[model samples]
Structure formats: structure tokens, C-alpha cells
Target: MAAPLSTRPVTMVSPFVAGGTNDLLCRLLAENMGKSLGTTFVVDNRAGANGNIGTAFVAKQPPDGQTLLMGNSATHGTNPTLYPNQPFDALKDFAPVCMVAAVPVVLAVSTELGINSVADLIAYAKKNPGKLAFGSSGIGGSGHLCGEIFKTATKLDMVHVPYKGDVPAIQEVMGGQLALAFVGVGPATVGIKSGKVKALAVASSRRASTLPDVHTVEEAGYKGVEVTQWYGLFARSGSPKDMLDRMSAAAKEALAKEEVREKMLTQSIEPTYLPADELNVFYRNEIKRFREVIQRLNIKVT
Candidate 1:
């Protein structure tokens, strides 16, 4: 028989470094879920290889429901296409637990560029061609894919500069070292509010609540540019159905709390919860979507 849920502490691995959106959400959800499940949830930061290191570690762990992964778009959706030889299969190696949240991608340009809107940026890019450049968190990240989608949709010939993370990329943009950056709302909000960068559009179906003035990519007259960074929970494959169900229940309960929702919203993260079965479908569709984007852009990890 499986060990009692409370017998041992649960370890949730955040593949990215600490202090990132993924890590923050993991800790927040883990805290609340721990309360709900009457167990301790510890966060393990295993940062490397764009989240592959920690993900592979979890994939190799025993599927006893004691270990889980706090996976995001980079790990589950884009890495398969970005990496030539992945150590773990996102779908085959894990069982979906629940989806945590989604954050919109903000298309911000250097204030020195004097570009006020998406139209202005597109016009400038068309006129300058290869002279324009955009930065991303990394090569295989959602920000990079968003830049590619923007290039494809607008038919712009801009160069891509990959950084170690969004903060550094945003810093480059602020310093006029880079022309544009597709960044998450967390960092982008500070830049936008401080006037260091100008937010032209958000790559989401709707405007982010935090950036009320920024228009959606579609609203800015650009189609097919919808992209958002999503976080989810997963466990090694072959975990017990009861364990998965219990975890999912705890996640849903935690998300439904007003405090949790407010805290997530304050960070410009939409607190979203999807059950295990639905999350599986959503995860597969996201992987397919990213695969198509990579193929269309001919993106290969260096």
C-alpha cells in the first residue's frame, strides 16, 4: 500500500531559479496546499538548462506522489522543440496534477526608440529592417517564441538577442542596448510604470488587469500573437490516481481562496486552476502549439 500522505513531507521542485514567477507561485501554492492537505510541501530549486535539469531529476524520481514538479511553459511546452535531445519527455514522464496560473507577455520597447504603439514599432521595424532587435529571457522561452510570432505576423526583419533571464533582457532594453523585449508582466510592469520602457501591446487574448492601458496584440491590429506564460503541477508517471486526485483537490481549494487569488493578481498573475484530466489536454495542446511555432520559425537551440 502507498504510504500515508502525512507520513513524509512533499517536495515540489521548481525547475527555475528562486525569485522568479515560477518559484513565487510554487511557494504560494505549496503553502496553501500544505495547509489544505495537512502536510508539508517543500520547494526545491534546481536551476539549469532552461528548467531541464530539475525536470529531468523529477522524471527520474519514484512516482510515489512524494515528489512533484512545478512546471511552466518552458519545461513542458517549448523545450521539446527547443532542445535537440531532451532528457525527459514532458508528457510521457509525468502525470498532470493541476494548473496554477497564467501571466501575460508584455511587448515593451526601449523608451529611447520613441515608439508609442505596436503600429509605430511595426512601422519602424519595416523601415529599418535588420536594424531592429528584440531580446528574450532565453532562446527556448515563451518570450523568445512571442518575438518570433511577432516577427512572423508582422513580417519584420528584426534580430533576436537572448539573455539569461527577463530582468537582464529588460535591463538591456531600458539601457537602449536592445530595441524591444517580450517580457512577462511581473518585470514589465515595473519598467512600464517607471517610464524606462514603453509597453506597446500585451500578447494575450485580453488586456492584463495590471496594465490596463496596454492593448492586446489583436487590438493593436496584429493577429496570431497571443501567448501567455502558464504554470502547472505534475508528478512522475505511474503515480496513484488517488494521490493525483487529492493533490488536485488541494490545489483547487487553495486557488479558490480570496487571499491566494488576490496575491496572484497583485503580481499580475491570473490564478487559474485546471483539474488533472483537463490539464493533460491543455498541456498536450500547448506542446503542439509550441512545436508548430518552432517549426514555422525554424528555431534551433544553440
Candidate 2:
């Protein structure tokens, strides 16, 4: 792929500001990927709309392989159900380039609460009924959805507390005003390490290596409670076949590199690169899978 026509620089778009985990990961890979292809790789931050704004921006860009989108679950899988008029269709508006990585969402509770496990949390919710309040980053966010799923799976009654972002939600939880939250490992790792929060379980099929002592929701005897924070790459549908193939190969090779693998591991993110066609299969299946949850919960924007 690095022939005479490989002089064009690739532009990568991230939906969060600099210093965020997404931005950091993209920046880290840019160096290696850029060197591999003999071209400049730049990360553009287009933060807003909970990632929709940046995603839509990239979705509308030309399918020239130069402009690529670092698509997350929120922008690609969950936005359709969350926003009534999502400007871009995750499946229709873009071409799947590759999957970057997957992070685990950990369920944690304030130490003052005395809840040590998923069963204990359910028991406490049952005992208190609507008294227990849980905070999330925002309505329809992954944290909120995780709580909703938990309530439905356990058949418990708990109040939903939506916050502006994870910062305030985590503050309230630490202050003992909010009992629990399913927080991203990026921010929650520090607190978990400092003993500020007690981790109940990870919301994935397997336990995270970062918290080997903690069990997964599935291991807690709860059926059908798997979740992951997945991130991937995409370009507008009709991107050049050769360019897409070349980029996909480069991405997979980068993931195999020790530096990329180590950086992802530091954030508790497991790097797994998927080819373009396989990513499309995943995107379609995720849409269908989440729709059932949204419908079952009667979740809507209005």
C-alpha cells in the first residue's frame, strides 16, 4: 500500500477532547500507523453531541480513505435509539474499516453502602425498593443503560439519577448520595485503586485482567448481562477498496505491536482488530441486538 500514491496523509477523527482515552489511543497509534504507510496521520477532535457531532462530520466526508472516523458504540450502535433524528445511520452512512479495541465497564459501589456483590446489590434494592438511587453520565448513555439492564434483569425497583457527566456522577457516588454506577474503567480505575469505590463486577463475558479479583456479571449468576465499550474505525461507504484494505491490514498489524498492545492494556482496553467485512457484520448485529433492549425497556428520547 505504500507505493507512489501513498503520499496522502490520513485524517482520523475523535469525538472527545484531547486527554481523553479515545484521543490518547488514537494519538498513540497515529505514530506507528503513519510510519508504516509513509504518510502523516493526524487526529482531529470534534467533540459534541455525545460523539454524534464528530461522527456525523466524518460520515458526511468523502470516502477517500484520507478521512476516517473512530466510531464508538454511542455513535454507531446506540445513537439510533437515543436520538430521534440521528444525522447519520451507523450501518448505512459509513463503511466499516476495522475494530480498534474493547473496554470493560465495571459496576462499582460506594464503600459506605456495604454492598459487596451483584446479589447483595439486588437484595439491598429489594429491601429498600425505590429508595436506592443510581447515577449515570446521562440519560440513554451506556452507564444509564447498564443500570436499566441491571434493574430489569434483577426485577428490582431503583430510581435513575442522570448526571451531566461521569465526573459529577462519580462525585455524588463517592459522597454517598448515589449508591452505584457502571463507570468506564478509564476514570474508575483510579478510584478503584485508591479504595474510594468497591468494584462489584465487570460487565463483560470475561473478567478484566486489571481487576482479576473481581468477577464478571455473568459469573455472578446473572444470565444475559454482557456489555463492552467497543471502538472501531470507519469511512464513508464507497471508500476505495484498495485503500481500505491497506489501512485495515496496517491497523491489525499495529494492534499486534508491543507498544500499541501495552498502551491499550494500561487503560484496561483489549486491542482486537477486525477487518472491514467482519466489522460490518458486527455493526449490523449490534444494531439488531440493542433495538430489542430499547424496545423492551420502552426507552425513547421524547
Candidate 3:
């Protein structure tokens, strides 16, 4: 975390465009934090490089408590393995503030594929071999990992395609440019609702509230493959303990608010308000899990 500083405006950077869940949550937390602390907490949009642009910017910011990083899965969990030469360290360069929520990924297929369930997809893949193709947001995103995990679990020989962002990947699947994809439920839900895509399963342990009809990967016969896109807050390493404590407390309070809880629930994001100690434990386990997956897949990002 950043070093202690006198009471000054805190500049919070979100690594996504406005209207996304990350952007929305950051704004909400900033507004609430500002109110609670009786000081301004400004949110700046630094969208690019699949969240790395803003995250790296915050990592290199002054080690004072004035700058905060609203980090998500792309920056924390996925980027570590995806970018072999990433300039900043997700764990070392940043002090853990709090874990905001877990965003689940949905396994969806185009309606034209005539696949309604995971079993159906697996059966078809078995028969078709390398004919089927799956797309994801990028090479090392939760969506990409989900598809790779599915391929390994089902012993399918389909191809993997990576796109720059979730919207384009999901849209391609909807437009028949691809057969299927695993995407964040927020964007996938729209296509599913429109009847353009069919939901097979989710990569979470339990079913998503947004799509109760869909089953979990375990239910689809792939156990121990649960993965969720998570979001959290961080500051430069060595940030004052008092400032970290204050931010963590404010985050916990904001997450516990009835309105915040309900809104997150509506978006199918499970709230996880973790203090520093517990958050570190969670991050360690996630890093380990990512390492195993990368080794198993022999994945190396350029």
C-alpha cells in the first residue's frame, strides 16, 4: 500500500469504461468513501490494455495514500500468467485493500449449434473432433481458462480463439462467427436473454441468480473447475496501515449496505468483504491455482 500522507483528495483509478460492473462499483465505493471520510474520493477512468493500462499506472504512482487502484481479474489473477513480462507485480507492488466481489463466467453456445447442454456439446465435440471452435475475451482471461478447462476435462479436440474483449467475443458467438464461448455472465446474459445464445453451464460452484436455468460445471460433470472473475482494491506497497485500515473498513461497510448488496446480487456478483489477512490467503490460493492451470495447459503468453 502507499505511504501515509496528509488529508488530501484520493484519486481512485478504474481500469474499465464507465457502465461496466467494475466502473459502477468503483464509483459507488468512491461516493460512499467520500461521504464516510468527509473528503473527496475521485474516480478516474483509465481504460485500455484489458485493464493493464490503469493498473500499471496505479502501480507506478506515488507510494502515498492519495492514489488507489481498483483492480479486477484481468489485472490481478489472469494478467500474471497471460503476460510473461508484465512490468508490475500484482501481489508485491500493490497492498491489498479489500476483495469486492466474485464475477461468474457463463458457458454459452450459439443457437444454430443445436447444443442445449454441456453433455450435448461434449457429445458433438467427440463426434466432430477439430471442427468446433470456441472463443474467449483473450488468451488468459477467465473465459479463456474456462474454455481450456472444459476442453481438457471433456477431452475435446476443438480449437480455441481469443478476442480482445468480452463484447466482441460474445457478439461473434451470437453472430455465428463462433460456435461457443465462456464469458462474464453480465454480457452473456444479454445474448441469452435475446435468444441468440444458449446457456449450457456456469463456471461457478452454484448456479447464477441471473440465469437460474443454467447449471454449474460440476453439475455438467466437470467438478473442481470452478473459476470466478474477481475484483478488488489496492494501493502501492508500503502504504500506511492506518490508511489501508480506513479504506478496508469503508469498503466492508459499503459492501454490507443493503442497497449495494442487492445491486451486486442482481448482477449475480457474490460479495466478499475480506480484510487484509484473509484477502492475502485468498490471493495466494488463487495464484497457486493459476500456476497449476498454466502448467497443465503449457500456456505462455507472448
Candidate 4:
């Protein structure tokens, strides 16, 4: 068994704001990993520019294993295409720690929309005619990507509206500020349960545990629209191999705990762990797929 990487507390940078799934998982792992590794872990929230601000901040940190980043599908997957001058290279600036969890994306609408299912939403959009608008966290965030995927799959010409984070988007949906939002299950859970907003379909292969009654994209008859927002741990590149291993080991330990797993599941976040090397491969593959999708969909920055 490897020892904890540092004598000092570790800082895990979450590249989004506080109420979203990324921040939620970041705090969860920080607390549990600290316990398992015998060191304190601090969570730093760096939000803005669709996760580029905090991601760039982490990329500049010292590679001593004391500073880790909680990266996700937005930073690693869609950012390259979304930000032409993004400061850090998602693949090159960080050493893979492990993949932490994946959350389904929900196409949720305000009850005011009178859209009860994916099919109804489509017909409503068609009837509305002049560019039905949709909301997301930001341009490159997972919600934005999921919206693009859903739009392409359904062949709907809709406008994209970017919010600061998932909570804001969901809030807008509940307030009827926007027609709907494609958001992660975690941040949308509260509104979904409150009945202020209702999910039309989950944009993943499986239904979300937090919203078990919601049908999946495939179940709603749109298989190509299935996508999940994945989160993972990463350290500044060139961190000591042993330190990286220790961090990976500690994160794995945290994820293996039953309490942590249950908390994540209840939030509609699925705990999916992958070792460092495997996670690196997964990140690269996801990045490639994202690049292809962005091009295929002509997803240009606004």
C-alpha cells in the first residue's frame, strides 16, 4: 500500500461553480479521500468560461500531488473545439488520476411548456417554428454538448442559450425563463422532485437513479442522443509517479466506500472508477469523439 502523497493537505480544483455535479463530486471525494489517505483535502471552486478558468488555474499549479483537479467531460472533451485559445491542453497539462463518476443528462422542461415526453417536445418545437431556444451551463459544458447532440439527433433547429452553471439553467426551466435545459441529473434533481420541472428523457443509456421514472433517450426513441457527463481526477503533469499512484489509490479507496457510493447514487451520479492509465485512454477517446461531434454538428462558439 502506498502512503498519502504529501505531508500537507491536498487541494482538488473543481472547474465549475458550487451547486453543480462537478462541485458536488469534488467535495464528496475531497472529504472521503482525505479520510482514507490520512491527509486533509480542500476543494477550490473555480468557475467561468465553461470551466476554462479553473482548468487553466490548475494546469499552472505545481505538480507535487498536493494539487489535483476534478476534470470532467466539458474540460477534457469539448473544450478544445469550443475555445480556440484555451490556455491548457486537456490531454497534455494533467496526469490522469482516476475517473470518479458519470451523471446522465436530462432534457427537462418547465411544466408550463406542456411537454410531457421527448416526442411532445419535438412536436411543440416544430409548431413554435422560429428557432425554439434551449439553455445550458455554458458553451462547452456537458449540458451544451448534450443539447447539441439532442438537437442533431432530432433534426431540430433550436437556439442555444448559455447560463453560468447547471443550477441557473435548471432555475430558468423551473421559472419558465427558457423552454428547457439539458442538465446533469444531480443539479436538476431538486427541481425534478419538486415538480417545478419535469424530465422528458435522460440522455444516457440508463435511467438515472435519482430520477428513476424518467425514460432514457433510447427508451424515448432517440438512441444517438444518449450521452453522459463524466467527471475524473487529475493532477498537474510531471507529478511524481509514486505520488500519482498514491492519489489514485486513495481516490479508489474513497469510491469503494459504500456510503460514498450511496450518496452519489442518490444524487443521480453513478460512481464509475477507472485507474489512471485506463482513464487516460478513456479521456483521449472521448476527446476524439467530441471533436468529431463538434465538427459534425458545426458547433461553433457564439
Residues 167-276, candidate 4: write the lDDT tens digits: 89999888888888998886688787778898888888778777788899899887778677889999899998887787788778888899999988987789888999
lDDT of 2 by residue, 1-302 (tens): 54732577789999877887778768877777777777788999999877888988988888787888888778877787777587778778898989988877778888888888888898888888889888877777777788788777778898888888777887777777778887777656766766778889888878887788999888898867766778888888888888878778878889999988888889778786778888899878777777778878777653
lDDT of 4: 0.85
Instruction: Count backbone clashes in candidate 3.
Output: 5
Please, what is the whole-model Cα lDDT of each candidate in the order they appear?
0.88, 0.80, 0.83, 0.85
Comparing 2 with 3 on TM-score, the higher-scoring candidate is: 2
User: Between candidates 1 and 2, which one is better according to TM-score?
Assistant: 2
* Model 4: CA > 4 A from native: 1-4, 18-20, 45-48, 295-302
Q: Comparing 2 and 4 by lDDT, which wins?
A: 4
Q: Which segments of model 3 are wrong by more than 4 Å?
A: 1-6, 262-268, 295-302
lDDT of 1 at 291: 96
Instruction: Rank all candidate structures by their TM-score, best first, as comma-separated numbers.
Output: 2, 1, 3, 4
Worst 10-residue stretch by lDDT in candidate 1? 1-10
Q: Which of the predicted structures, 1 or 4, would earn the higher lDDT when compared with the native?
A: 1
Q: TM-scores, in order shown?
A: 0.92, 0.92, 0.88, 0.84
Candidate 1 steric clashes: 0
Sorted by lDDT (best first), the order is 1, 4, 3, 2
Clashing pairs in 1: none
